[model samples]
Target chain A: MTALPASTPRKMGLVIDLDTCVGCHACVTACKGWNTENYGAPLSDTDAYGADPVGTFLNRVHSYEVTPAEGTPFTVHFPKSCLHCEDAPCVTVCPTGASYKRAEDGIVLVNEDHCIGCGLCAWACPYGARELDAVAGVMKKCTLCVDRIYNETLPEVDRLPACVRTCPAGARHFGDLADPGSAVSRLVAERGGMDLMPEQGTRPVNKYLPPRPRDALTATPAATPADPSTEGLGGFLGWIDRTLARF
Target chain B: MHPAPSIILFTTISGLGLGLLAFLGIGMIEPTGLAAFLWFTLGYGLTLVGLASSAFHLGHPERALRAFTQWRTSWLSREAVLAAVAMLVLAPHAIGLIFFNRPLTGFGIIGGLLALQTVLATSMIYGQLRTVPRWNHWTTPTLFLISAITGGALLSGLPFLSQMLLAWLAVAMVLHWILGDSRFAASGSTLGSATGLGARGAVRQLEPPHTGTNYLLREMAYVVARRHVVPLRLIALLAACVLPSVLLWIAPFSLPAIAAAILLHILGMLTARWLFFAQAEHVVGLYYGVR
Candidate 1:
């Protein structure tokens, strides 16, 4: 079961734009909120109210400062979750048949009941996609809001992953990346979306839209120094009077 | 990359147990009466105990049997299956040695090979992980197998074989630290590459997403200071490898000398194995800015 399918019917994934992300933890919270309730078991925290607190979360927004060669360095917010890789090491490295990718939708998930909590999947993950529920001692990750997306009772617009729905900046996009004409696919092509570590060879399904390029660095403009004879307020007043007298 | 105590003990104890089994299978040390009873009890007893210790590492000890299901892909599963097979096959071999006066050549051949194979499979569990570039090396397995063999040789009380294996152990450890350990800094991965920002000159974590230590940081972002690596390497080499060889040279004269050598080597390997897990740089550490 750990051997990946030859191909999935659809490569369902998220595409994120780095340019507009505000580093708000909205998506992170939304993901935690939804998955904690809807998933088979709650993503638990060990010491929630104590001085040292740890909770399992499916997604996180990392803030990175990128210093370019020429321009002033800028900070970029990166919201990271499971990429649902085509060749997910997590799926292959699991001792139990607990962790798996759906052949129908290409969404990777963990069957908690079968998980022995060996944590090998965590070791295999390059992106840190999986987190252990300290309370349940089982692996948990982003299910791409599988429950809501497929729920017929929910409104179509509201049925996306919790992270995608709750993003105030609309930086997150969801669609079938395998489909050339899907909005997410078009976004990937137009913006030159990239894989986080293409060399790691997870062949991640999620694509990241690179930050839009800006004009090369230009020197900061300096204010022209005042002439010695006409620098003060009286000089300006005299110039103003001369103009009035001429009128 | 954090070396959990349970795992450290499991690998160390289990390696020692399996190595003893390997030596016994090869008919290197011929024991009689009480010594034979001691050897078998120690061999199978330590093996089982070490394996039992690993169950403590699981979140649900009751669900540990489910780990046996996946051998096609997982190295962990393969390790379990191979370990089980080695134990099962060796159990009867132990019975034959204890009950019958004659050795079963067939059981010895198969059991010895399987015992060594189990240790090799255990090494592969960490070696195959691409996430930790420090561990994904040939030296990792070589170091593990050599350490096991050296331990086995020493405990089996073969003074000559112990000396030779001690030398081999030193070579493996040196090659492992020199080639394998050094490759981490030289690896092409950078914070930029980790975050898809390689086009930028430099990238650093200004602020972590969460204030508290998450599972990723707790589990993978373990950091060892650069200054400590050398001294520890020396301790591991001198105490674990060379000291054993020198002690084994005098072991023929004094039993205490051989015992000292085994103790020193085990201590040394414990240090080295601790370093093995502690220093492993998981690519996920880049997310936490520990790499």
Candidate 2:
């Protein structure tokens, strides 16, 4: 085998634009569709198209209507999923070494064959990312499309995850987070992006740009039409006239 | 803390086994009816077998012997030792009931001690897990105590309080589940104790460590949705505690009620055990970038 040149570490992640996302759930659907097919086991539903259906979904969007300090009403659709943390507690708690992070690209993954179905990783997570495949007796979660992103068969532009590709509003961006010049890094730097539950200390790489102010995006509401007769008439005759006009 | 089924089976089975043995020894001193003795013995024997079978779920069964070595520090080890002691005492006590016309005064005392030890050891298993804030409380011990007392009481009063015990168990399970989710403000001793940066505000994530799921996320990130949690909690309460209690209360002295009580107590104890693991919050939650 030809020896390749030693390379420095690379940090890969996603930057999601909260301002532009329309809460379409396309990314959620794309993620579920891709992961259900590729992950350790299919995210099977016990009673799909029936009462009380249950299954694993890798990504979900939460829409919250925020009335800020200024008292302006605006809706912010927050798409929540696994924020792959640097100090992942899930990996440390696994009695089996099935849960591990890659040193090369900072991608954390589970070796399904090594998993003993202990569900320890499920207990160690706080973001509700991992789910147990009760049928296969193993754990499952989002891979960020590890297979597609690294595949040489796909074009460079199409290397992003299915979730990123399917986002209709261009809210999701995937790239090397370590490079200061990368689009994600620059966007995070410029927009003051935030991570969900940062106090969790998992050091999640995904960034969520805060929603833009309501006034900055929408026009003010116009004044309501006035009742012209109300100001002019005050007596019984005016009431009679108004009643006649109503008839 | 999703209660792994193996663990649920282990704790519940063992709890009933130890609990029934304790009551059987108590009944010997006071001379309860022959029916009570029969039911208690049956409950204890069944639970013993169930607990033994649960040993198969462990990763290293042969090394289970090594588990006894950690009695000074490990509740699990203590539980094993106490279980063995209970078995020893119950064997002689059962023999006396069957063959020897002699009363079980001596063996009963030993059985009581063994039962107490089992309950304490079981409580300590969860109480000792400092990483899990929910399991680390006095409530854990109280829950274990309640399981033992209620299980024993049901077995002792068989055909009478079986339903009531089951109902109490159901209510206890609901309370346990609710308490499991309510977030206590970070105190000086718990998950918040690590940072000591008491700002008295909710901590939101500013950044996370990586872009992919790791072991901590996989283990700790499992969440029971609001919709499912309520119904499951109710089912666990009804099947495990409430229904049994009602059946036992209305039809006390009935063999079917006694049977139902034993079955429901076991089921409730298992649900309670599952919730015990599921609701626990680890100190590692501190490292998840939370305050």
Candidate 3:
């Protein structure tokens, strides 16, 4: 086995563009597929097409509609998963070392063999990322597709991740954020991205670019023209409109 | 969060063990059923041994003696100490019941005190976790009391009293779930409070400290799907409370029914316990980027 490089103090991560995301759920499906196939254990569903079906998934999309006082209708779809925090409370709380963050890539992975199926890691996460695999009796989560990204056999263009590769909207981006010149780093820098639930202080690696003005997509409504024949009626209606507006 | 099976078993078994012992002590004054006494003592002994076996899950089993040091603050310590005391009192009381054929006046009182201590200590285990808003409540103590009393009554094999206890347990479960859900909702909002800032504080996450998963996420950041929670909660209530109550009522004095009630209670308790931890919103949750 090729040994990983020496531990470095600095950690790298992803920056997601929430504004561009279309809530396709492709990322969620991609993550599930990749992890189930390659992770330490398979993510099993009791009944895929039957009643009372349950399984493990690391990524999920939450769609919300936000109406600002001055803006048109806006819909925000936030695809949330693990933030891969630096001061991960989930790590320290584990009684066993089965749950640990890599000193190299900073990837948090569960040693399936060592896991006692104590669901403490799930409790520590604020993002609701981790889920228990009832069949395997271990915890499962987003690996950022660790196995796929580093495989030398894959072509360079296809080496990113299932989520990033399959994002039809191109909302998700993955790279070494430590390099300021990287695409993710530059996008975060120029777009003035915001982190979700920043107050939690877990220091989520992912960033969300806020939705831009809808004026870019659609033309603003022009002022209505006064009908010359209805001038008298318009005057009366304008007075009523002003009065109603006050209330 | 999926707690280790050992811990789950420990809490459930011990609750049954100590709870039955406490119930027997309460009823001992009335010269009632010898059969009830026999079943209660048997259940208590078995549960105690089961609870003790769970010690193997501890990383430092030999150092379990040190667990008593923090009885002042730690419910775990209090539980250890009280459980030991309960066993001591229970053994002598059992002997008195069998050999002395004497009125268990003094031993009964001692057993009662130990039972009370066990209930309090058991409650404290969850109640003391201030991080878990759902658990850190007065209702937790009430739930503990009800669980012990209900479990004890079921194991006693006394149909009528078991039925009554089962009904009380159903009410207790409902009250606990309602109160617990409300507490969870309240703490969910306090995700903002975790940053130690007031609700208006503008603290926002800019970047996560690490790239990959860590121990904290593995231990605390677990979530069950929202869709599953409601159904599971109802199922837990049915198994833990409703079914047991119905069984107790229909077959008030049946040993099979009583045994079924005990088994159902264990299942229900386990589900409730899982939800208890799963629903609990910790201040640490704020750190994990949840609101």
Candidate 4:
């Protein structure tokens, strides 16, 4: 059961736009809020108000400073979660049959009932997407909001991943990536979306659109200094300065 | 890479116990009565204790039986299965030798092979992890297997073989460390690669995801001071290999001397195993800007 499915019926995943993310952590908070209440186990925070607080989270936002050779350095906000890879090492590395990728939707999930919490799945993941909840004693990961995505109870507009729905910048898009006609797939194609650590061979379903290039640093010329002595002051303030100088 | 005491104990002590079982299963020392009882007891006792220590590392230790079910793909599952099979198969042989004063070579050979397989599976649990480049190499399994072989030779009181293997273990460990030192850099997992921003420019962590530590950082981003590595490696090599080998070679073949050598050897192995886990660098650390 830990073996990955040969192929999924639909690769349901996310396409995150790095250029649009504002690093506000709204998606991170939304994901945490939704997952803790609905998922396999509640993400618990140990020592919440204490000096060394630790907790489990399905998603996180990291800011990186990129310094190009000829341009000004800029900060890029990166939100990270499980990519739900076609060849997910985390699922296969699990000693118990708790971790598995859904054959229908391609979403990787954990069955809390069977997990021994050995932390091997967490170690197997290169992206640090899986976290062992201290209170629940089970591995927690991003489920892509499986419950909300399919629930007819919620309005059609609300039927989306908590992160995607909450992103004010609209940086996150979710759909069936397996379909080339999907909006997510078109966005990836147009923006030249790329995979993180492609050498890892995970075949991650989530793609990241790189930030667009900023204006050239050397485009603006240096401004010349005004000749203060040659052009005498002609305003009321200048007259006051003359009087003060005479005194 | 936190070098948890439970894991260190499991790898070091369990490897030795399983190694001893491997040798005994091959009928290396066909003892009778009390001697057979003591040898069998030590072998099983060390193994059970090591396994228990490993179980303590799990968050849901009560659900450990589930680990035995996924041997089709999981190395950890295979290890549990193999260990159980080895113990069960060897039980009858052990009993026959102790009570009936007879050797069951058929069962002994089968159990011995299973014990070695269990050790291999245990090593593979770490070796199979590509996320940790240092442990992903073929050298990982080689080092673990050699350690078991050497420890088994020493525990079984094979003086010449143990001495040679001790020297061999020193050479192998030095090579393992030397090769492992460059693995992270060689892995090509820089911050830029991790973020998929390498084409743009050099990348550095400007702000972390959280102000306080989380489970990922605590579990993977463990930083062992560089200055400690040299001294610890020296201690591991000296205590585990050089001292044990020399002690065995120079000292007479007596119970007290052998016991002293074994104690020193165990001390050395503990140090070595500690370094093994502590020195490993996981690729996830690149995201945290720690590697």
> CAPRI verdict on model 3?
incorrect
Kindly report the docking quality category of candidate 2. Answer: incorrect
lDDT of 3 by residue, A39-125 (tens): 578877766666555667777665554444454545556677776666565554444455677777667676666555546456556
- Report the lDDT tens digits of candidate 1 across residue range B149-193: 888888888888888888888898888777876666666667787
Can you give the lDDT of residue A59 in candidate 2? 72
Task: Residues A9-38, candidate 2: write the lDDT tens digits.
Answer: 776778888799888889988987887777
lDDT of each candidate versus the true structure: 0.86, 0.63, 0.65, 0.90
What are the fnat scores of the candidates, in the order listed? 0.86, 0.01, 0.02, 0.88
Candidate 4 runs further than 4 Å off: A223-247
Q: What is the lDDT of residue A92 in candidate 2?
A: 54
Number of the predicted model whose lDDT against the real structure is largest: 4
Interface RMSDs of all predictions?
1.0, 11.0, 11.0, 0.7
Candidate 1 — which pairs collide?
A: none
Task: Identify the candidate with maximal TM-score.
Answer: 4
Estimated TM-score per prediction?
Answer: 0.94, 0.56, 0.54, 0.96
Alpha carbon deviation, residue A168, candidate 1 (Å): 1.1
Candidate 1 reaches a DockQ of: 0.75
lDDT of 1 by residue, A1-247 (tens): 7888889979999999999899999999999899888767898887899999899999999999988877788889999999999999999988889999999989999999999988989999999999888888888889999998888899988889999999999999999998999999999999998997777888999999888887763777686767545434467787896677677
Candidate 4 residue lDDT tens string, B102-212:
989999999988988989999999998889999988888888888988888888889888998888898889988999999888888889899999878889999999999
B148 Cα displacement, candidate 3 (Å): 6.6
Candidates 1 and 3, the one with greater DockQ: 1
Please identify model 3 stretches exceeding 4 Å from their true place: A1-8, A49-54, A92-95, A176-186, A189-192, A198-201, A216-247, B1-13, B16-132, B136-291
Candidates ranked, most accurate by TM-score first: 4, 1, 2, 3
- Residues B19-116 of candidate 2: C-alpha lDDT, one tens digit per residue: 77776675533444465457556657756775666565543344346445435433555677787777778666666665554447678778866886
